[model samples]
Target chain A: MIITNIETVPGRTIVEHYGIVQGSTVRAKHVGVDCVAGCQNTFGGELKGYSQLLEESRNEAMDRMIKQAQQLGANAIVNVRFGTSMITQGASEILAYGTAVRLE
Target chain B: MADFLFFVVFVTAVFFIGQHIQKKHFASLEAREQALLYLPAVVGRKVFNDDDVERAWLVHGTVVVSGDYFKMMLAGLIKFFGGRISAYESLLDRSRREALLRMKEAAASEGAHMVVNVRFETSKIDGGNPSQQTTGMFEMLTYGTAIRLKAQ
Candidate 1:
């Protein structure tokens, strides 16, 4: 499905709107990854493990949102947005939401 | 006495090493930005259509950056004085630029000419209690729709 973070997808017209669809997931890294990240923190560099974990979780959230839009018979999603929050110490919740619409 | 000595040595090492790494990162970010200057990324929300557009799709980049203990402690001291914590400024700037550059690179890799409606999401990830530890880090995510024009 076509997705854009604007009101309308480029080169496409929205013929119908299906309101808002959202998906969210909370995730954390394994102990080993966390330990590695902790060691890397001392030198102040990129935390690859955390980055990968968060990106994967974000993709999963977007996938769920896209599935919801697909179920709504929408060919595209627009005005998409992402949200993140720490649920606990290590776990974080990633959210993807957007308006589902049919394009012509 | 040994504990205090170790603390001083560790802080000194982090200060010099962290500053060096940050300078290197900035230099690399500048070089990459110049190389990718041809690809325009904009945050305009208004929709505009180009008749020559061939395809459009969403692209994103994510980065997690950490701060050294020296900066973290400096920020703490500044907090007591109720002034700006400038030490963390570079950390934030570095991550934002890195994330945006990565997004532009992704669009370029897809052979897209431009990225529009760019949005950034930033969040702190301490991984544990903030007061108990001196660690500081954040994640930055930038995304937009990459547009490829029809070849003439």
Candidate 2:
């Protein structure tokens, strides 16, 4: 399915709306990565592992949202937005949401 | 005594190296900003200056950056007093500009004349340490539709 954050897709016309759909995932760093990240906090630089963790979290959330849209028979999703929260000291929650619609 | 000395050395080394790297990154960003000045204007709204669109497609760019030790230290102090945190401001500024530049470059590479309906998203990834007040990484993401206006 076509996915975009813009209100309208460039070439597609919306035929039906499936309302709002959302997916979210919570992730926490493992002990080893947490140790590495602790070093990064002191040393001050890009934490590649944490970055990757967030990326994975976001992608999983997005995929789940897409799956929901597919189940709803949506051909496209628009106005997609992402939200994040620090669920706990060691955990982060990533949420992806959008309007599912049928495109012509 | 030996362990204390090693700790001092490690902090000093990281501080100096991080400074060097930041300086280099700032210089490079400045140069690239100048270079990207002529790229298409990217805005958040959907109104296109030229309506004769022959072709258009979505484009996106992302950048990940983190603060140095000095910056984090400054941020920590600012958090206590609670004023404008210029250290984090520069970090955000750099990330935003870098992401936009990457988007512009992507449009240019695709031979598009302009980009519209631009949107930006930011995410912070902090190390899972409760005691650490500073974020470990920040990501700036920008996306828009590149348009090719028909020749007049």
Would you list the C-alpha lDDT of every candidate in the order shown? Answer: 0.86, 0.73
Q: Which ten residues in a row have the lowest lDDT in candidate 2 chain B?
A: B125-134
* Residue-by-residue lDDT tens digits, candidate 2, A11-96: 55689999999999998878998677666665554566765676687779888999999999998888887777666656768888
| Each prediction's number of clashing residue pairs | 0, 0
Residue pairs that clash (backbone atoms under 3 angstroms), model 2: none
Q: Which ten residues in a row have the lowest lDDT in candidate 1 chain A?
A: A4-13
Candidate 2's TM-score reads 0.75
Q: Give the DockQ of candidate 2.
A: 0.32
Candidate 1 residue-wise lDDT at B33: 94
Q: Please state the error at residue A98 of candidate 1 in Å.
A: 0.4
| Candidate 1 lDDT by residue in tens digits, A25-50 | 99876899878988778778789998
The sequence of per-residue lDDT tens digits that candidate 2 reaches over residues B52-104 is 66666666666656776666766778899899998778667876877788788
Residues B1-152, candidate 1: write the lDDT tens digits.
Answer: 99999989988988999989999999999999999999989987444456777888889999988887778788778898897788878888888999999999989998998998899988986654456563856899999988888888
